[model samples]
Target: MGLRHKKASAGGGHSTSGISPNSTNGTSGTSPDISENRPSWRRDPLEYNLDRSWDINAAPTTRVFNLTSSEIQAAPDGVLRPLFVINGQFPGPLIRVNQGDRVLVNVTNQLSNGTSMHWHGFYQNGTNWMDGTVGITQCAIPPGESFLYDFTVKQFGTYWYHSHFSSQYTDGLVGPFIVHSPEESKIQEMYDYDQVVLLQDYYHDLSAALLPGYLSSGNENAEPLPDNGLIQGTNFFNCSSYDSDSGYACDQNSTRAIFNVAQGKRYRFRLINTGAFGEFQVSIDNHTIQVIEADSTLVHPVTVNRLPIHVAQRYSILFHANQTTTNYWFRARMNDYCFSDQNPVLDTDVRALITYTNSTSDPAPTESVDWTYALDTACEDLAPSSLIPYDPLPAPQVDITYPIEISFQIGDFALDKAYINSTTWVPPAIPTLNQAVAGLQVNNANFTTSGVSTAFDSSQLVIDVPTYKVIDVLINSLDEGAHPFHLHGHQFWIMASGAHGAFNWNSYPTLNMTNPMRRDTITVDAFGWALIRFKADNPGLWALHCHISWHMEAGLLMQFQTRNDIMRGWAVPSDVLALCHVK
Candidate 1:
């Protein structure tokens, strides 16, 4: 069946806030009025909490979400700027659904520019067009138009949705997506409450406004440093850092997000790092958390005082509220060392309040003590080897290997560009999937190959896997900065990773095949390499790229044309193709 955007009923000028009441299964609940422009700090944290009463045992049904993209002037921190919000909320609204449910999101674009929504970590098996990746599966939903993203969520856990068009998500278009399942019943019992904790690096300027300087010549390693960091879309920014006439509307009354819990309860905080550039070291004063899930994969409980989370990565930790009935600090320290340079006005310490019931006062300096463990100097994710999957699924033997080298080089104009091998990606006028399907249907030899495809231009780096096979991808980084690499559509087994050195061809036989932390995102440290394997059974064109927004805009992305044998029989959706017709 074909999918199309249903027009809003006449006389109702599209409600710009809240999920549709007609949604089946469970709705994320009502969101605050976006037109009010109230800062997140003043709003109750419970309003942002996910409703835990969703019936997990209910039969699968379609869950509908109406999301409108528009620009609004607001201050996530204390500094005011124009933010692209969904349903008028900064950290968009929550989308919670059961594992087998179908998700139909009608994304209405009211912004001046085009936009698309990507359900991060969801494998769009037969519905590649629903992937919502601009330049890959489909084109952007042009201004004043809407697109229906219909897909079934086959996996369960914490996921998120964001504007896959350019660096728009960094400007505010982000929200949490949680998939519940009967399989999680055992894990669910350990927590008395569940909620999402968003961590992001806050910038005073819009990403579009900062792109020109970052992409200019002689700025190879310089990424725009954030002015501050945020937890649940709120943080206190010292306005004095900006000059009296700095042309910024600063409000010193901004406060930190407060998460209230009972003294002897357990909380499942699903942490999602939605920032454009910074990696955060997360911790709660005087509390050690048990990490139960990593990137949609349930893992054996691992206790740690502090958690290092890179951009686009997620971790669900269980926090036991066994402390005294008092407020404590919930810290998310931005790892500024990862940036080539720092903003003088930037505050690396980002905090929120973990207050007990009936306690509203802030924690005094001497009252709450942070974890004494030394901070992480390395800009990388927690060791992959340390997190073992709860379910033991041995990785299959590899059938082929593709070694890709990633680096940043100053090109002909002395402009910095990221490269995978010798190719740098520039979004084609037509998506790679559109090109691949047509070529495969015509029985083009180039499109039916087992390696790279020559059917597309040099700007598109596509590796074609014509049939089902266990593939190994060795990603080696040549740059000095650590990168968090995310692969779309599939969660691969992390065979091995190193902070330095090449993947030893001799060590292939000894690599861990006993469920080696299968995840969708991983960090390849500075001058490091990662070996990942996945079965090419899913039919579609998928992207593999750096999750860092600036780095991606610089061209650190590639596509995998998988299961072309199956894609050849597919027909492009008319509604999806319509997006490309817009100017």
Candidate 2:
């Protein structure tokens, strides 16, 4: 299977005025699109081992990416239908390692279509060449070919990886990559249990997959209905489905989806939001998640019943399931409200199960469960910098990190249309999204963006910004939905965010220089705006946008170029730049 250039799709296209529709009317139902009622996803696992190789051609095929679920699925179900997985799982696989350990992921694309992998939120460090960005840092490895991604695991905490080229992640192509603290040997005795719980939303209506086809087709009607929430892949209880094909009822539950736990143990729940475009509020049987880390950076522990995460963000929480009973139910939910909508009554709550004990019930339906994982405490501090291998260089000019107004003035989703530089935005033979990457508003109003990626020249930037140079950004959305904007290679502190150009910068606590949590992504409110900042340190072309694949494929992205160390000079490798094949 091959990656095709953007073209007209059966789903829909983008239009210049507003969201237009083709086959999907944003409403799907034998009845009216049920905004209140929803679905039950399967219990699944997102796990995998890092496959390493110096020789790409000789890479071993031990199924590097393992989607810990126990479901039976076949890839390329028909002709070019990709299964949204690398090795038979929604989230491609899990990559785990110890701090300071060298990491190498020999990606082998065995599925039916062409794809590219992203090391989401991972500090590219000295290995800027390995940071995954299709058609920019490097081109997608063609089918029948493989690539060896080698890098050292410098930072510890929670991180993830996903598909970068297209919206395959929406169909379920994602996974977790964990780097344990070098201090793990000492911290091991602090807890008696450890488990990873990742959350993600899915679009199971296979035939209706949209947005992506519209990248080139410009058809808005083809866009699938907005699917707002999701549960952990491994939490939904085993629900039996009835198949009339053979006039029989059998258990169709995936074997790899079930989880086992003990009654008394101090467990660590590595919480993640892999939502291509959703924010989730997680709960676990009425228990508050004692959060230990944010975006993989350790912080003073904080506790809360619920904490929200945008696309590509991660959290680590600790809990003691020391319940007297043998079983305890756990749940996680994604709300309809984001910076955009702030209150989308139309959004549904997503649910999943977590059992503290496997003991069975006496064949009777029973109680309700409500719980969420969150930070236990917080402090003013900055994470100690790891010994990144890059040479120290001079910093770039930090001109005005001034605020920019957002205007979702692009094309309509229902009609294949758009505008670039105030003119109609047309798809390039090889599309370059820069022209359409500014001031995106989703629903024909003043809105904010979570974050979007664009490109910039090394020459046009301000160098060596003085200390305390604050950059304020105003994102406006044109669409009715929210977008989680993430910045590659850097972390920004939140200033403020709200729908319709509203913000509370003076009221919110400013991130202190001490104990600052490094993050890669921050979600913009639905039809809202987000105010965030970070020291412009890293020098490279970075992407900023919603983690949601479909929105990105549409146009919710842009770029930034920062020179943290000016003396280091432009270190992007020669061969890696060639890989991008930029004319």
Q: Highest TM-score: give the candidate number.
A: 1
1-583 in candidate 2: lDDT tens per residue? 0011113230112111211111212111111121122222221232221122112222122212222212234321111122455454444445655555556566766545555677887767666557776633456555555666766665666787876766666666666777665344444444455555667754433422455464543444233433334443432222222224633222333221223445555656777777654456665564556766667655545766766655677777777655555333444444433322232222334544444444333111244445323421211111223211122222223335444332234345444432111222221322121111121212211111122222222211112221224344455544444455677766665544554456655654442333333456654543456656665555444565555565555444555544323313334545443433433
- Score each candidate by Cα lDDT: 0.84, 0.45
For residues 1-583, what per-residue lDDT tens digits would candidate 1 score against the true structure?
A: 0001112230112212336222311212112232134554233344556666667777777777899999988887879898888877777877877877777899999999989999999999899999989999999999999999888889999999999998899999998888888888888889877778889988888899998998898876478778999887888899999998889999896767777777687888899999888889999998899999999999999999999999999999998888877778989998866666657899898998777744446797777889999888788788888899998899999999999999989988899898999998888879988888888778888888789888899999999999999999999988888888999999999999998889899999999887899999998888889999999999999999998888888899999989887898998899988889977
Per-prediction TM-score? 0.93, 0.66
Q: Candidate 1 local accuracy as lDDT?
A: 0.84
Q: Model 2 reaches what TM-score against the true structure?
A: 0.66
Q: What's the CA error at residue 540 for candidate 1, in Å?
A: 0.8
Q: Which ten contiguous residues of candidate 1 have the minimum total lDDT? A: 1-10
